[model samples]
Target: MFDTEREIIESKIRLCLDCGKCTVVCPVAQHDPEFNPRLIAQRRLSQNSHSPQDETIWQCISCYMCVERCNYYVKFPEFIHGLRAEALAEGAQLQCTHGGALQALQHMMAREDLLQDRLSWLPQDIELSEQSDTIFFVGCAPYFDIVFSDLEVNTLKGVEGALRLLNRAQIPFNILANERCCGRDLLLQGDREGFLALAKANMQEFARYGVKKIITNCPECHYTLKVDYPNVLGDTGIQVMHLTEVIAPLVQSGELSLGELEKRATYHDPCTLGRCSRIFDEPRQILRAVTGLDVVEMEQSREKALCCGASPWVYCGAVNRQIQDQRLTQATATGADILVTTCPKCQIHLRCAQKSRDGKIPQVEIQDLAFLAARSLDIGGESVG
Candidate 1:
């Protein structure tokens, strides 16, 4: 398997025409000139040996910007994942942010029999069934709230927004009694076995509930369940849809009524939702449907949008801050009152960047798309609690 994987990665890298397009768009290379994708490809091609301890491999944020920019369609983010897997197999230590506490939490959740109170954040007004054919996969929002409390971000609000929308639309969905992390963090950290463990546990729970469809507010959860889970666990014959995809149609068809927002906002396309999953229009369409919400286009909107500068909860530093600051600058340049993003991770990272600045508060307020939708529906306030 390892040999086949290496060969596949090499085949992709072989298509590189020594063009510097990948480096030009790389977030890390923009700040840290030493970490260049073109050079990494050249070095990997020239050397017959594979080193799991390559520091440069972990520097990639897996934003897929290089893949988007590559004329030859080389999958640079996938290539980095392959390299990271080899490194992990060689007993290499990954540079995890937050002292690896979040990664540790994921590993701790792998136990199949562990019981969790994951639904503590479910609002009192939201109604869910004991069991249903459809399940709401609330991925790690509670954990994120606990871990990132210092950032003063209501990560769980995204979950609330999702539940509120479902309730208003009268869509019956069941919440998982024992949902674990989606294992995206582990997969991105190069822990394939750990990811598989979490995947198996989650799948077993899904099977126990006889779930046929899943709705998720988190893009990482949606991507992992819809795309990554099938790769390892075979097709579970389950359909997964992000909250934006589900809500877009409601707003578009007049099934769900949204009141006026009366604010100018710019949408930041989360890398997972836009570049990875190809969901570019639904969120914008939802925003456009609002009565008074003025949707402004950032210079880098849609597929060309920049990443939030952190991935897998690891390797965040000066370079990451620079990237986040630059993206926030671009958002502010639009003169929009708010910067709206569909992913919780994007909201947290951008909010953190906003707070870290020494001067006056950031001109633009960072918000999750779901929260805005909930506000328009008058189902819930902006706060989590």
Candidate 2:
């Protein structure tokens, strides 16, 4: 299976034209000149050996920038994942930033008998149905808070924000008590077997609940379930949507009322949500509906937006920090008091950068779009922004 996957990925790699557009748009290549997508393709094509210890292979960040920028339609990120899978199969150790604790947690979730208190973060006031066709798939928020608690980022707030919006819209949704990680990190980290196991287990759980539609606040989860799951498990007979996709229409139709927020804010497009899924307008639409709130554009807006640096919770270093700092600088340049993004990981990564700054760069408030939208509804006590 691994050999067949590698062959398929290499077939895509063979289409690289060496135009250097991918390298120009890559956030990692911008900071580390040594990291070049064109060169990586060339080297892979020239070499017949698969070296799992190749450090450069793991630095791609899986941002999909190369694939987006490729004129020949070469899927570079998929190629990198294939290479990483080969490496992992060769017993090559990965340098996971969280000391592999998060990976271990994901592996633990694959157990069929494992019981998780995943809904502990759900507010008591939030309305949920015992048997609903729609499930609000809260992806890995419980684990993210524990993993990134040191950064003081309340990852669970994104979940709360999502729930608040659902409640305000009066949308009947169900929460899965045995919800598992969407296996996005595992898939990106080249743990194909692990990712498939989690996907299969989660699908079984979803089947048991008779889920027809899934609404997720996490872009990674949205992408994995909407795109990856179908590829791996065939037709899932389920519809997947990002929270913005669901809420934007409600805001526009006057089904949801948003209070005026007197602040200027810029939106950061998560790669999965924007470039991969082409969900560029829903977020902006929702933001514009908030009266008195000004939406500013960063130089790199929409498809051209830069990554938040960290991905798959691994290979974070000086290069990733530089990318984050550059993105924050751009956000500050917009003169927006707040920077809002649709992905929880984007909020966490940007907030981590904001916290570590040495008081030199102007600090912009980092917020999740769902959180800000929830605040605008005035359903919660304090403004998340």
Candidate 3:
């Protein structure tokens, strides 16, 4: 499902005409000159038959803005994912601090105890359904790792929220504790072997559950499951959904009440969430429902929103710091006191960017829509943001 290397991808590049329309609309380009999708596509075509270019290719956040803006309809994430795979084949991997994150991901996957312990945030007695039509898969992130302590709680809340919505709507879902990491990090880092392993594990677990649909809050997980899984796992009869997509209907029907929120805020579209999956409205609709909250739109909004600069991995020192400053400045310029997003990765990176700003510029509060929605609903919850 992730493969994009074919005559068609090359054909799209040839037709690109170097229009630069994609660059003008790229979210990453707003904050990062190093991450121009158009330039990357041009470079891929000029390469000596798949020779790896600079590490910047790996820096793409899998946001689909480039595709949306490009007249060629080039598949940005598939191309980048393929490029990273080829780079590793050429003996180049993640550059800078991103390499450290790669190591951490590998370590967590290798240690089952760590994986099990990662979900310590839930109660031991909390009931988890073993048989239902749908299952909620929560992707691993720093916030879920740090705050939940027990991975079960953070994962459970997602399931709980889904279950609550489902219960009210009479929709039921099963919980799969055996689901492993979606291997998106490895895929982004070009660890094809690791990605395949995790994919196989997740596929086997999904098979055991015998479900036809899967829902997850994490865009990374949603992307991996919906796009990549089918390539390796065949037709598992599963439809992957973001929690926002699943909950939107419930919210629309008044199953999930939108409570009072009195603040000015803007939304950051997660590359994996909005760009990769074309999910731009569900989160926005939720935000809109909040009473008295002003939802400010950034100059680069929706399909053209800027990247948070923390995915494929973080750059170190001045490079990453500078990118963060640029994003914060844009967010603050919206005249919003808070910035909301759906992806945990976006939340973490933006918050880090916020902290790095440290009052030098007008600082805006960073938060995930889940936490914000939870706040709106008076549902007790915590966020890494």
Candidate 4:
């Protein structure tokens, strides 16, 4: 629907100083030495066979580490995104994880005629208001419940965790029974058409429900809805907020009281939430609100945080596991018994790596930030992080 990625990349390419800073900071390059960002730029601009379809393009996790570290402001991840769209037009495809089941799930939600049974995970007691103009968007966790069953992760639990907090804080919001996937993965994989289709459909849903604002627990959904939707679909009057952004103030004001949790925890900043969206503090603030929970930091935190290595959900290989192991090891080094994250995908990827390693890495429990916060809340019942 737009011009080719070359023009944008070319403008930035000219500014590139052939600096190896991108390569030095790249998590993928750290694990796999051959996949260099500086080299990737040279090869991509050259006439040699290292084309967009080459592994060089797909190898990027799009963590934006290079762009974060680059003095020249070269958006290598955005370059890959554009090149992927171009490559995909020429029959190139990424080796998607889960046998492309996750991608297939996204495509199914793009259908205008389809009605998704998406609200089965909603808790019985959480209050919902039919007249409320706000929506607590539950993105892809219900389907992930079935698809990522092997990991034994209940992503819906994370959603429930967020919902319960909203209820406790007396924030009235409705859940979209037919909410579609955010189509972030589709856009990343170069299926721009699919991404656009879903974005339009989701906007239509927002209009139909009179949605004035959206709050979500998933960082990917938050980033896509808060940033991507408006950029692609124009300003649709709907504003988006991550659950942490909405709840952190309540915790700080003493409106929402959380019980104590005696555990040592280290936070993993999801790339989309921390670096991409600059929501580094809210999650940490919420974690700190839990009384007696010792929050430790990894060596790489905030702008320099290591990626979850599962962005866009493509090319899950040894390199991804290596990065996951590195992250898990970092948590271990911090002497934290639990590794907390706000992103469900990060939890899944790290948990999968832990599963694969079979006690090779340190055995730190992976927990969701909102869930951990929710666990601390007990107006009547009990919970855990």
lDDT of 1: 0.85
**Candidate no. 2 TM-score:** 0.95
lDDT of each: 0.85, 0.85, 0.67, 0.83
Model 3 lDDT per residue over 182-277, tens place: 887777666777787788777777776787888777788888899777765676678988878877877788776767788999998877787677
Please, what are the lDDT tens digits per residue for candidate 4 over residues 87-150? 8888886788888888877888889987877776666788999899999998888888788888
Model 2, range 246-320, lDDT digits (tens) per residue? 989988898877878889999999999988898999999999999899999999989888888887877888898
> Per-residue lDDT tens digits of candidate 1, residues 42-94?
77667655643558888899999998999998988777777778778878888
For model 3, the superposed segments whose C-alpha errors exceed 4 Å read 1-11, 26-40, 47-55, 96-102, 107-115, 123-127, 142-144, 147-171, 314-320, 382-385
C-alpha TM-scores of all predictions: 0.95, 0.95, 0.82, 0.95
Query: Candidate 4: which stretches are off by over 4 Å?
Result: 6-11, 47-52, 379-385
Please list the residue runs of candidate 2 whose C-alpha ends up more than 4 Å from where it truly belongs after superposition.
1-7, 51-53, 381-385
Error of 3 at 143 (Å): 7.0
lDDT of 4 at 83: 73
Q: In candidate 2, residue 194 scores what lDDT? A: 94
Query: What is candidate 4's local distance difference test score?
Result: 0.83
Clashes of 3: 8
